[model samples]
Each structure stands twice: as C-alpha cells, then as structure tokens.
Target: MAETKGLGYELIWKFDMPTTINHIMIMEDIQYGELIRKYKVEGKVNGEWRILTEGESVEHKRIQKFDKVEVRGIR
Candidate 1:
C-alpha cells in the first residue's frame, strides 16, 4: 500500500511489454475526508494515453473492469 499526504500526487505502473488489462482495483485506508476522493485510471495504447476509468468521491475499496485492452503502462 502507498499513501500521499497532499493533493496532485500520482501512482503509476509500467509493464515490460504490451499486455491485456481487464480489471483494476484500488485499496485505500479509511481516512474520511483525507482519503482519495477522486481518481482516474489511464493506460497507454498505441503510443497514446487514454482514460479507462474515472471516479469522484470514491470509497475505501474500488474495483473496475472493462473489455481487455492492450497496454504497456497505467497511471
């Protein structure tokens, strides 16, 4: 688990090669208003970055699934 105390922080993951991604899960500590309330998930596809999912006022545990997409990185 990772945590940031301020706003505008980002977490990213990079893969060695293109891979299919079908699901994403985010876990957060229960910190009320201090928790992550909004976030966006993006993936690199065909040399371009695209948004796969986005949320506002999110909860402690969030999960998202979509049609498998080829990607080399996510943030």
Candidate 2:
C-alpha cells in the first residue's frame, strides 16, 4: 500500500432509550409548569465506535446499514 495518512475519530454511541415516556407531571397550578419525564437507561458501548473522518460529531453520519457499533440495546 502507498503512504496514506490522515486522522481518524473514535466515539461511543447509544441508540436505544430505556423506559418509554408515559405521564406528564403538573406543578402547583402554574402555567407551562407541566413537566414531562422519560425514563431512559444509560446505554454503553463495548468498544469504541470508530470513524475514518477527523474531528466530526457522528450525529446523522450515514453509517452503513451493517456498520459495526457497540451498543447495549436496539434502537
């Protein structure tokens, strides 16, 4: 292979959220005081999610359908 060089990036991604949102909580008669709480489990990666691009937030990055991501749950 020829001399190829550049920087790569690594990250961890969590896809699935834990408990589904169910109810809304209302404060003492205050308008816009209704609070929505959703329970979510902290997802973790078994390994680093590596990207060839440099210094990029992987959000919305088009990974291959089968791209390897170490996640604790299904999205």
TM-score against native, each model: 0.79, 0.16
Q: Report lDDT (Cα) of residue 55, candidate 1.
A: 85
Runs of candidate 2 with Cα error greater than 4 angstroms are 1-31, 48-75
lDDT of 1 at 13: 73
lDDT of 2 by residue, 1-75 (tens): 112233242222334432222221222332545232322222234533323222222232223233333444321
Q: lDDT (CA) for every model shown?
A: 0.79, 0.29
**Pick by TM-score: which candidate is best?**
1
Give the C-alpha miss distance for residue 54 in model 1, angstroms: 0.4
lDDT of 1 by residue, 1-75 (tens): 132233357876777889898989988777644478788989989988999998875577778988899998888
Stretches of candidate 1 exceeding 4 Å from the true structure: 1-8, 31-34
> With candidate 1 superimposed using the best TM-score fit, by how many Å does residue 59's alpha carbon deviate from the native?
1.8
How many clashes does the backbone of model 2 have?
A: 0
